[model samples]
Target: MQLGAEDTKAIITRMKRAHGHLGSVIRMLEEGAECEDALTQLAAVNKAISRSGYALVATGLQHCMAEGGPDSVDAKKLEKLFLSLA
Candidate 1:
């Protein structure tokens, strides 16, 4: 789904930060950093990515509803999309 800046600025920023954090996580693994530290960062990156997915789904749903009205939304599809994130 196409996202406008207004609808996705925070989400985009979060994903970008998570992208950087993932790189760090990879580097930590490559350098054999402490397991606890690496795992902590990795977990944070994972949660950030999941949150981004949820936010994107929310934006898409809102856009669909606003543009096409509530009747145009397919509940089954929305549920599937949300479940995929889970």
Candidate 2:
């Protein structure tokens, strides 16, 4: 199922933030920033990306349920997708 506008926008915004974080990480590495600081920023980037992925999967699951409840094949697939991220 296609994502609703709000979900799409939210996921895109999160991804954009993650993208910026990743760029910062690269710049930090180039500048030989402290290892701990770079690692902390990298962790933030990872968390942001993970949150965006979860949001996307949640939206898919929500749409699948609305269309036909959780017993549907699509819902099962979405469940698997959600679990894979764990």
Candidate 3:
């Protein structure tokens, strides 16, 4: 989980993009935009954030597994980690 500057920057970039999308949803709501349109945008933002989070988790797991070697594949821990994310 100890990401270097470049890796951290990549995560930050994804977060910023998600934030921007969230802001757009807020702006649309504040402007009294169509409900369906706003909901659609909200869904898109949610999907983006979920995808980004999963990607980060997968990257972290991959790095941990690599460092920890073959025995790192603990089913219980993996299930816990995934459930906690959910």
Candidate 4:
């Protein structure tokens, strides 16, 4: 399913934020930050990316269900796509 306009915008915003967060994690490592501190920031970045993936799947599922009848939606395909993120 094509991304709904709002979903696309939200996803882009999330990705951009994640990009900035990831840069911070990298910088922290380069600056000789404590291992624990750098790892914490890295975990935040990972969580952000995972959340974005979930948002994408959830939005696509909604779009597919709304645009096509229930019978037209492929549950298996969507499930695989969602699980791939895991």
Candidate 5:
């Protein structure tokens, strides 16, 4: 299912934040930051990415359920996608 403009914007915003966090983590590593500090930044980046993934999956599930009900193939596909992240 196609995403509405708002959902697409929200997803893109999440991905952009994740991208920025990843860049910061890379910079921290390159700058010889403390291991603990670097690890903390890395964890933040990981969480941001995970949140983005969850948002995408949630949007897909929402659309699938609305359009085809919970038992539809699209819903199953979205479920698999979400589980793969785990």
Candidate 6:
């Protein structure tokens, strides 16, 4: 899907932040952090990544649907695309 340059940059920023969070979780683990604390970080990182991916899928689907026209081929293609994301 084609995204505006600014929108693409924003998405990239979100992904980079998520990547950083995962790295932090790894560093914390290496330092032998508490199990509960590590687990919480793990959950947060997972949620962040998942949310980012979902946002991309939603935006792409919206764009596709808009371009494809109501109940058109593009919409069906977008439905499949969204399902794959799920």
The candidate that achieves the highest lDDT relative to the unseen native structure: 1
* Candidate 3 clash figure, as a count: 0
Q: Look at candidate 2 and give me any clashing residue pairs.
A: none
On the 0 to 100 scale, the lDDT of residue 72 in model 3 is 73
Best by TM-score: 4
Higher-ranked by TM-score: 5 or 6: 5
Against the unseen true structure, what C-alpha lDDT does each candidate score? Answer: 0.93, 0.85, 0.81, 0.87, 0.83, 0.77
lDDT of 6 by residue, 1-86 (tens): 68676656767788899899899989999999998999999999888877787788777666656877656446566678667656
Candidate 4 wrong stretches, greater than 4 Å: none
Model 2 agreement with the true structure over 31-63: per-residue lDDT tens digits: 999999999999999999999899888777777
Q: CA lDDT of 42 in candidate 2?
A: 99
Q: Candidate 1's residue-wise lDDT over 2-84, tens digit each?
A: 77889999899999999999999999999989999999999999999999999999999999988889997899999999999
Q: What number of clashing residue pairs does each candidate have, in the order they appear?
A: 0, 0, 0, 0, 0, 0
Error of 3 at 61 (Å): 1.3
lDDT over C-alpha atoms for residue 50 of model 5: 90
Output the TM-score of candidate 3: 0.83
| lDDT for position 28 in model 2 | 100
The lDDT, on a scale of 0 to 1, for candidate 6 is 0.77
Candidate 1 Cα errors over 4 Å, as ranges: none
lDDT string, candidate 4, 1-86, tens digits: 56757768988899899999999989989999999999998999899999999988888877777888688778899889988998
Clashes of 2: 0
Q: How much does each candidate deviate from the true structure in C-alpha RMSD?
A: 1.3, 1.8, 1.8, 1.1, 1.8, 2.3
Candidate 3: residue 14 lDDT (0-100): 85
| Candidate numbers sorted by lDDT from highest down | 1, 4, 2, 5, 3, 6
Between candidates 2 and 5, which one is better according to TM-score? 2
Give the deviation of candidate 3 from the true structure as CA RMSD.
1.8
Clashing pairs in 4: none
lDDT of 3 by residue, 1-86 (tens): 47567656777788789899999999999999999999999999888878777777777777778889768767787778787768
